[model samples]
Every structure is written in C-alpha cells, then in structure tokens.
Target chain A: MTTGAKRPKRQTAKRTPPKAPPPWDPSIVVFACNWCSYAGADTAGVSRIQHQPHFRMIRVMCSGRIQPGFVLRAFEKGADGVLVSGCHFGDCHYIFGNERAVEQFEKTKEVVKLLGLEEGRLRLEWISAAEGVRFAQVINEFTDQVRTLGPSPWNGKRQQSVGRAAGQRPTTES
Target chain B: MPELAEAAKKTKAWACYDCGKCTATCPIARVGGSYSPRRHVLATNLGQQREIVENNTLFTCLTCSLCDRRCPAQVTYTELVRDLRELSHGHGVEPECPHGGALQSVMRMMAKGGTQQNRMGWLSQDLKTESAKGQVFYWTGCTMYYDAFFPEFQVKTLEGTRSAVRLMNKLGINPVVSPDERCCGHDLLWNGDRKSFELLAEHNVKLVANSGAELLVTSCAECLRTWKVDYEPFFGAKPPRIVHVTEYLAEHLPDLKFDTDRAAGTGPDGDGSRGPVRVTYQDPCRLGRHLGIYFAPRQLLEALPGVELSEMRRSEAAAICCAGGTWSNCDRFAKQIQVERLREARATGAQVLVTACPKCQVHFRCAMKDPNLGGEIEIEMRDVVELVDQAVGQK
Candidate 1:
C-alpha cells in the first residue's frame, strides 16, 4: 500500500452483555383453615407424603378469616402465589364459614386478577382433615404452576426499593 | 411535637381566631359526632400533641375543605387535618378503615409496584387507547379495584371510565392508557400514609414522564385532586396538564353532537316525547371545594339535549361530602350523612342523581341499600360521563 493511502479501520467486535440468569424458587403463601386444610397438611406430614416445600402456611381459624386484605397483603409483601384452602362447603366447623369463604375468595380472585397477576397464581380449594394425598397433590401442582410462571414481578429489586422508599425494612425472605 | 408545630404553621392552623365556622360547616360535626374541626385546630394551636394523637377523631375528618371555604381567617382546616394525620400515622397509629382495610391494602400494594396490572380488562373493543405513548394520558385510578371490591353495590365503576374513553375517541383523540399506571395515592395521602403515597406519586410521575403526555385526564375527582395538588412536589418543574373528564368534555362541547332523539325517553317516565329529564347534580368535594370546578359538569349536563339540571339546596361550594371519604370512619355518622344527602336529591324531584365521582355513587348506593331506609333514598345515581355517553350515542 502507498504511504498516502488511508488504512481501513479495524472492526471492533460488538460486546454482547450476558443474559440474566433465570429466576428460580417462587415463594407462595397458603392460608389454611385450622379445621381442615391445616390438619390435612399435618396429616400429609405424618404420612411422609413428599411435596413442594416452597409454600409457608398461615393457619387461620377458618378460611372466612382470610379477607381480601390478607391475600393482597401477601402479594404486596412479595408472594409469588396465594392458596386459600378451607373445608368443603358443608363441612366447615362453623357450618357457613366455608360458604362465606367462597364469597371472600371470589372477591380476592377478582382483585388479584385485576392487579395483573396470573389467574393460576391464586387458587381456592376444599380439603377435609383426612385428605393427606390431596394436600400433597395441591402443593406439588401449585408449586409447579408457580415455577412455570417464574419469580413474581412483585418480588426482587423493585419490591425492595418500594420497601426502602416506604421507610420499612426490606424483607429478608425471597 | 416539632412536626406538629411545623404542620400547624404550614397549614395556617395558627389563624383559627377561635371561630367556630369550621365546626359549623363540618358535615361530620353536624351529624352529631364529637369530631370537631375547631377542637382539632385548638389542640394543634395549643400544642396538645398527646390529645391530637390519642383522639380517633383525627381520622374522621373527611378533608372535604368545605370549612376552608367558610373560614374567614383563611385557615386550611382540611390540610391541617391531613398534616395532623401524617403526624399521627408516623407514631404507628392507624385509621380504623372501613372494609377491613382491604381497599387500603390494595392502594399500598399498588405503591409497592412491580406487578403488571391488568387494568385494561374493562377496555371494551370500541374504546380506543394508545398502547405506549401519546399526547393525552388517561388515568383509570383504582376503579378496577373498586369494582371488584364492592360487587355487592352492583355499581359498574369501569363503565364511567370506558365511557370517558369513548368520549375521547369521539373527539378523534386516542389517549394513552398505561397498564403500568398505579394509584394516584389520594386516599393514601389523606390516610396519612405519606411514605406509601410518595412511592405511588413517584411511580405515577415517572410513568407519565415516560409516556411524554401533554395532557392527563382522569374520571375520578379524587384522582384529579391527587395528581393536580398532592403530586405537585414530586413532579418537580414539568407536570402534565391535568383535567377532570367533565372539564375536558365541556371544553369540546361545541364539537360534540348528542342524538336528542335517543336521549328523549331516558327519564323515569317512559313517555318517549315528553319534557327533558330532570336530573340533580351532587358536587363532589374534590371537584368543587378543592379544585373550584363548580360549572364544568353543569355546563356539560346543560348541553345535553334532553337533560335538565336541578340544583340541590347544598350546591357548589356549599355542597356536602359523600360522608365516607378515603374509606375511613364509615360509621353511623357517615351513614346518616349519606342518607341526608340522598334525601336532598330525592327532594329535588329529580329522576336521576348525577355525580362526577365514582366514590360518591358507591357511598350513595350503599346508603340506599340500608334495610331500614326502605328505598326512601333510592334515586338512580349516574356519573356525568355515563349520561354524556348515553346522549352521544354509540359509534
């Protein structure tokens, strides 16, 4: 090449940023009625039934005690899924508590859906005190559903920032 | 104590002059509650922090600002209450909110962010909306949550919002409706949850900035006040031009066409070709006393071909509150206030009670559902936008 000739510029390789790792281990909150679902969970434990351990159970006296606020609060505090479990319609210890739970569940589900959460994230089920297999099955199914959906959009960095912004301590749980 | 002193100074609670005008004008006080605005001011002026904090009456003030209108000394009684509430809330005291605080929780959750809201479920096929960014941004403002929460009331809160969009579409403007938009935090701020309110305000302000909107329109009166007044500090220098839907519609009144033939028989009387429908208007406190928008809704109603405006005795600046505000202290006093307001509407001989606020509609409907009232206060309540939508006819 001549001394006056302009040398071609060297091609710089475009640096592609590494992709973010896939989010794992969805957190779920389960409101279990003390009369049935909670007992059923205990039965599942006693029978050595293997199930997903991703959910934390809150034992309310009845599912009727699980108001829309409770479910919304769970989601607000960064739950990936919420399962409200009670006794069957006619089997509530207080007779109409389960029926009232159905009403409350419907209200909570509407709010959860409107908040842009996946419908699969919220579930309501009836389990008797003896249904250990059913409890395990529900746990496995719910955990799988949440897994496919990945970590909640309401969790992670954004939630932590919100907590900080609101002058509350950031929760340690994922 | 320093905060209390600061709040008193900021809100001009020092200018009370020992006048009982605020107490006299207070709807809550008139309903025979021990909650007196005058007393609250006195407590603040005297630096009685313990009494102010201990009294549950702090949460009972509607912050309607009617007293502000009547305060000869120019004392902002509403802002004083708000400041006091903020101070009290900082002390870990909470308002005994109605609905088991479900609505408050919803608002707080919205403040927390990160959820992709399905707020557009109410957007039917006909109503046009921009997906990303536009000149006009429409804030839906918790109507979706309200609809789901108060299904027993059978009030279609989203119907008002959808109608608003329809009206905008008629004017050839497809407003930006963001699913990412959160609550305007009116109730949270009024509820004295300042931290949550600030978070929501920041989120909404940033979202609006991202949308690059010049005009922000909302259907809820409370949202209008929140965005226009409460979000001012967070917005810094540039904020979107905000207007209530009625104000927006009123501005474009000349261009809008109403099919009077379609609206002729919408009155209680099914007679197709009779006189214009007699409708009374309830001035929402936020739209009237707070924002000084007394005529926009009336102008729109008057423009409708077959709708006649009937003024309640308590109209404009003198209008009463919906009794239940920010979803707190909804006790018998609130019920009594609602019942009285509804009776006033009934007395006006209007077939329909037209209001611009969804919360007003909800509260009135709840009062009407009282088993003892026996339908005495059961006038058909309609949002002003809904009536306009009905008159404009479907495209």
Candidate 2:
C-alpha cells in the first residue's frame, strides 16, 4: 500500500512531450490511379513495407485522369517531384485509360524539360495492382531522382520582388 | 484485313487497368449518355469485346487525352481508344454525336485533302507550302489552317519557325517545308474514321519520306504526338526524327538572342507595383502531360525579362482540359469544360496565360467566351512561341 501511494508525489514533475521531426520539404506527390496503381500502393502499406516518408498519394480514377496541371500544381505547391503510376499497358481498370495517360505523360515530360526542372521532377510509370514492390521501387527511385534535382529552380526563381529578371519570379505559397 | 491483326498485335491495349478516369474526364461523356469511356474500358478489358465495339462510347471519345492526363497507369487511353475506334469503324460500327452530323462534314473535308489547303488560312493571300526539297519536312496539321481564328498566331509561329530553321541552317541543319503535306491523321484517328486516318498517315509519312527530309518538324502538339506514337507503331521502323518547334528552340536557346524592347514592356501601371504582372501558364494536355515537355516553355517564360510567372492550381501533370482538341467542340458540354478551365486559369491572377500548343490557345479562347466565366476575368492568352516571337524581333 505504501508503494502504490508513492506515485501521487510526482505531480510537480510535469514532463513536456518531445516535438516531432521537421516536415520534409519539396514533398513528393504521387497520384496513383486506382485499380492498378492504387491497389499496388495499398499492398505496399499492408505489407508493412518502408518507403520514403516524402511521398504523398492522391488516388485517382486512372493515371489518364491525371492532368498536366495537377503535376504543375504540385510543383507550384512546393513539391519537388510528382509521380504518376498506373497499370501497365493494356492493364488499366478502364480499358485504354492508360493509353491516354501515356500520351499526356509524353507531353508533360516536355513541359518539365521546358520548366528547367531537373529531368525526373515529373515521372510516369505503369504499376499493376499486384506490383506492390514495383510501386515501392518507383517511389524510391523517383524520390531519389527528385532529391538530386534539389528544390525546383522555380521554387527560388519565382520572384516576388520587382526589378528581378522575369525568370526569377519569387516563389509564392502554392 | 490489311494486316489489321498483325498491326493490332503490336498495340499495348491488352494491359488496360479499367479505372474509368478517362470516362470521368471525357468531355463527350458529360453530354451524351450514349457513351461511357469507363464502361467501354471495362468491357474491353473483360473481353466483352462486342459491347466495346458495338456501343457508341467508342466513337464519342474526343480522344483529347484529358482522361489520359489524369490516368495513373500511363496507359495511353486516348491512343488505345483510337485504335479500338479504328477497329470498330473497320468492323462497321458508327459513332453517335450531338453535332447532328457535323462531324461527318469535317470527315469529308479530311478525305478530300481540304484540310491541307486550309492549313494557312491565316495568310493574307494564298500561301503555298514549299517542298522540303531534300531537307526537314515541317508538318502543319489541320488546326493551323482551317481554324481561321488563330491567324496571327499561325503566321507569327510560321515566321519564328522559319527563322529557327534558318538558324539551324547556320548551324549546319537544313529543314524543308512540304507543299503537298497532308494532315497528320489526328482528327481522322480520334474521330473514329480509321480508313481516313490510315490514308492520311500513309500519305503524310510517304510525303515526308519522299521529301527527302531527315527529320519531321511540326508546330502542332497533336501532330507531333501522333507521328511519334501512332505512326511510329504502325511502321515498326523509326520514322523520321520528329521535333516540335519549341524543342528545336530550347536546343538552340544559347545561340539565340532577343530584343528586350520587343519582348519586355513597362506595365500599364507604369509604377510597376506588381511583380512582373502575374502571368499564369497552362500546359496543353498533349504538350505538357503527353509529351512531358513542361519546363521548356517555363524556361522560355522565365527567360523573358521582368516577367512574373505564376501557375494555375493545376498545371503540368494536372493541367485541366480546355476541351478544344479531339473533337470536344462537337460535344454540348464543351462550353462548360472551357468555362471551368478558364476559371482555373484566371484564379492564378495572371494577366496573361501562356501555352505552347496552338490548339490550347484556341480552346482557351473558346472557354473564355462563355458569359459565365469569360466576363468574370479578362486574361490574354498567348502561345509560348508567340511570346517568344514578341520577345524576339517581330520577324
């Protein structure tokens, strides 16, 4: 009984919890189309796999549903890289949906190049629902690729100050 | 029957994921209950072959790649749909349309080579396409010609393109222009007119080869994409090296110089209170998402002196469809889509929205005309090349 009563004396020693680690900058936003890519991502989660903490996923209907604007938005919003993963060829839950996405990806790649973003800031891949490992691999590889690119040139080029060069627009909060 | 199966064997449609994103983003699906790209996709993957081929959904696909832009799979949904539509048309299935048969009228024009003749309507006089004459063949697809609304753009772009080619010549590269160049089979293939697409593709490919051009250059994003993907797949061998005009410029930017006076100007405010006049950029679905060429245009924009470049909420991979390309103009919901996109563009607070592809400019203009959104904001839309043209000398 005396030992149990000893716990009540500790009220003066209130301990503050430790602060969480700082957020990862240049966050990677992955739009995983449902059916193939989303399921693949889910599998990666269920399998208790460890992947990059920077990747945030937005499950879309299909990779084809991803618009170029969405990727640009991610970059504008401070994401260093954007990845789109879907079913492989002929494997979209929606027939031919990936086909359209591939076409769009082709165009967006050129846009990425134009922005002077590092080569891998924007990526397109086909990951099947069964390819949980592949999904994780893509994330790892793309995350590394983006990390090498550092902050998007635009992140610093966006100049809010006047008299700065046109290309140097100050980065606004996306 | 002409190696259809053999050709079909080469396509990757067998890997579809059936996400229905294509249907959701499809402009046609919005208006016509007669079609569902999602259903067509599901049916196709399930090998419910009959339903996919027989249903009007196959045809109603604007083939715009909006769905593909959103698709996570990178399946090339638009291209697959085109392939399937071609097969369906070959098998005698007709697509349904709300245009009350106007699409057929355009198809007739395509068949008669009227599209070629109309390509340069922006020219003050009849403009003749000079032969490549053993140089690079420049493919000016239908939108540049028949769509008379974008005349200044076409003319200026042609001028810039010509200058760029001359610059290339200085660098030991000679590009050719084909007077007899045909359409790149974009409309025909997307419209479900397979026979016409094949005929045009064959004609254009043959014309390019016959011109003795080592590379094929084009201003149209759709034409470049079709030549690279659809046509290349058909021929097996690598076709001519296809280059978009913007790509060519980016390659030569170091050597190129521009006049600051022409490209940059003091704002109307005079005080320059704003940071380089917040200009938003719209990535054409084909130019931005399909081709993955997002940065070149941005680089060009950034290079402009005193220009503040902003972005729409969705750009690059998430860029919304203006719904202008792939026959979306024929759909009733086309206006609504245009309005929605215009709103997004305006929200960026950019006085000018710059894009690389001419079709995107056309679509943006169409969307801006809607009473609902058009009046809400006043934005000037210019092609990246046009902006470059302005930045450089008037040519």
Candidate 3:
C-alpha cells in the first residue's frame, strides 16, 4: 500500500493504553433533619457503629427546610453523593415535616437525575431517631455505591479545572 | 443549533411515547381536540422547522402545564411550547400582540437598563409606605400600569397594592416600595423573549439588591414566582427572599389584630359583624401549582371574620390558568376559558371572586362585563389583600 494511504492489516498486536481509574474515595454531604435523622446520625456515632467517615452533615430543623438548592449546593461543592434523611413518614416531630420532604423529593430527584448525576448519587430516606444501626448501614452502602460512580461531574474540585480555559488560573473554591 | 439541542433536552421533546395522553388531557385540545400537543411533538420530532415556528398553535398554548402534568411519558410540554416560542421568535414569526403591542412594548422598554417608571402613581399619601430603605420591600409589580392599560375593565388592580401596604402598615411593619421597579419579566420569558427577560431580571435584581431589603414581598403571585424561581437560578447569587404577600402576611398572622367586631355588616345575618360573605378564590396558577402556595391565600380568608372561603372545583394544583396569562396567546379560547371559569365561580354562590393576581382580576372583570354573557355571571372580583385591608380598617 502507498504510504499514508490505508494501513489497517494487523489485528493481533493491540497496544491498549491503560485506563486510569476514577478517584474511588467519594466525598459525601448529608443533610440530616434535627428531629430524627440528625439524632439517628448521633446515635450511630455514639453506638460505635461502623460506617464511612467521609460525609459532612448539616443539621436542618426539619426535613421540610431542606430545599433543592441546598442539595445542589452540596453537589456543586464537590460532593460525590448527597443523602437527605428525615423522620419516618408519620413519625415526623413536626407532624408532616417528612411529608413535605417527600413531596419535594419527587421534583428534586427528577432534576438531580437529569443533570447526569445518577439517581443513586442523590438519595432521600426516612430514618428514625432510634435507627442508629440502619443509619450506619445506609452510610456504608451509599459510600460504596458512590465509590463505584467515581467523582461527580459537578464536584467543585474537578469543575474548577475542567472549566478553566488554557492559561487561566484555576478557581479557588475547592 | 445549540439552542435547539438545549431546548430538546429541556423539554424532552425527543421522548416520544406517541400515546397522545398529553393531547387527551390538554385544556386547549379539550376545547377543540384539533391542533393536538401530540401533533406538535410529532412535528418537533420530524424537524418541521417552518411549520413549528409559523403555525398558529405555537401562540395558542396557555402554557398551563396540564399536558406536561398529564403526560405519561413525563415530557415537559410546557417547556416545549416555550422553546417553540423562542424558535418562532428566532424565525420572526411572532403572533399579533393583544393590545396593539402596547403592553409588550412597555415591558420591553423597562428592560433597557435604566428607564424611570412612575410605577408608584397608585400609592396614596394616606397609606404608610417606607422609602427604598426598609428591610422588607413591597413589589407592586406593574399594578398601576395594568390599571392604565385596562381602564375599560375598571379593574382597580392598584387597590391590591394599596391594601397590602395598608395591612402591612397596620401591622406596624413599614415596607420599602419603589417607583423604579419594572416588570418582573414573567410574560417575556414564557413568550420566548429571553433577551428581554434577562435584561428585566438583572435590572430588577440589582434594584432590589441596592435597596438593601432583606426580604422582597409581593402581592402579585406571578411576580413572586418569577422572582423566586427564574431570577434566583439565573442570578447565581443568593437572591433576597421573595414571598407572596399572603404567605408573608399569613406567616406573621399570629400577632394580627383580627378585631371581629368590625365585620358585623359582612356577616350572613344581613350584617357584616359575624356572618360570613360567600367567596370563592381563583388560585393563580403561578401561586398554586408553580409555587405550591395553595393554602396561604385561603388561610387568610378562612381566618378573616365574616368571610366564608369556598373552594372552586378546579382549585389548587388543578387550577385553571388565567385567561390573560401570555399576551402572545391571546385568542377567543382565552376569553372563553375566562367566561366559563366565571360561571363556575358564580355557581358556588360566591358573591365576590377573590384572586391574588392582577391579571386574573383584569381578565375576569373583562369577561364579566362582556355583552355576550348578558350580565348573567354577576360576580365582584376583589383581591384578597383588599379584603384584608378592609378587615384592618374602614379605609
């Protein structure tokens, strides 16, 4: 064949460039309702339950106060996963606080998933104040799942670099 | 091409179930069942660029989200309609503006950076309004101007703003209100005029920001929705807390002086003291479905003495959109919907039809006065804030 014309004859010797694995250590953010989920998280720590230690938790008075903006803010701040937990459905300390959370979760989940953030990355659960073991289990499971998903596209750490143009200094947010 | 792609993803116009559930439940289609939303989606998929932009159906949509809500495929038909309007605008195939384009022109003029607007001409000296220095800013959005535009309808929409101010003043809270405040760009955005929407949004945001107001209170439901939902996301900054007057007032109602003695004559006993006036509320779509604020307006009415708060059959999430919502979509369908809605309100034995938005007041009043109806639907349309004002004092 003429030089630079057509040269795809060999099929045996394939030189595969090594694929670099994603950062497996996930940074998670959790918004725990003060009346139940926050207490549940505290119980988990006090009981010495084994769970992932990579979450920054913010305690809101009620799950009803956890707006979609708060969840998206966490993701933007480099969170690989966000867990929004409140009281059991009917056991909300403030009557129907968890009901409000459930209502907002439906809309928020759709938007979160649409942003290419896998549905699992943004989770909503009803964890009671006494469910310390369940809370720990959820954390461990969520951490592992997020680890498989790798770094979040919205992660502040990565976006600063990804969005940077050639020669522009990286943002100092991360 | 980029706009088309983004619009596609936003609307899920590509997601085709071909089930026609959207068309089945669409209010517009129910009126005729011709020009179905499914056809629009099919047209979109076929890349029928010319027909999509130039067709009358593009401007006929109420943008009410009924189709979007009922779509089994979860396709956002409302957003699709909006994006189509944008494409139509790009292709220069705009609909005939309802009022010789006067209203649209006023809104567009407000967007050109700094245009001095005497929006506060409705403010009376008797009402205690703080300068642009209070912690709470009252957003009297286009109420005075709406009064000027629809003078024939005799809808004193500015009365809502006055009532809100009076109620706030009675509560010992002085709210900042400005004459410089322009349109909230609610119509412009939905009409596919994003450039004008952005200009108005940025201008209003900066104006409110400079006022040093911690919270922005609006009696207008559309204004509250636009400011809270659209402007906040676009600004990328912590927008000042935006609240509907009903919500803001209801939140602080615990300390309100509900002096029941003055409501004597309005009572059912041919006296306002204790008997309740039979009233039905028109849930402004922006207030009810868009912001999920169905209860606040009702709560105020229910709490007021000599007020019987009745529910319209299609209230709350299923509330019908106001007839004069999108200026681009003005048609016989819009007027017919308003007339029918008025009949529903009148059927409830509601002497007074209470609504939270000025546009609702204007449209309902216009329909009520139509000779075609022959004055059969005789119902007084009043803003809930006006009732609140009367409850507080005689003036």
Best by TM-score: 1
What TM-score would each prediction reach against the true structure?
0.88, 0.57, 0.66
Relative to the true structure, how large is the alpha-carbon lDDT of every model? Answer: 0.86, 0.62, 0.76
Per-prediction DockQ, in order? 0.45, 0.01, 0.01
Error of 1 at B63 (Å): 1.2
Error at B24, model 3, angstroms: 2.1
Identify the CAPRI category of the predicted complex in candidate 2: incorrect
The residue-by-residue lDDT of candidate 1 on B328-369, one tens digit each, is 879888899999999999999998999999999889888999
Which scores greater on lDDT, model 2 or model 3? 3
At residue A84, give the lDDT of candidate 3. Answer: 93
Give every candidate's TM-score on chain A: 0.77, 0.73, 0.75
What value does the lDDT take at residue B35 in candidate 1?
79
How does model 3 score on DockQ?
0.01
Candidate 2, which segments miss by more than 4 Å at Cα? A1-174, B1-36, B64-76, B91-130, B149-175, B233-238, B266-277, B372-374
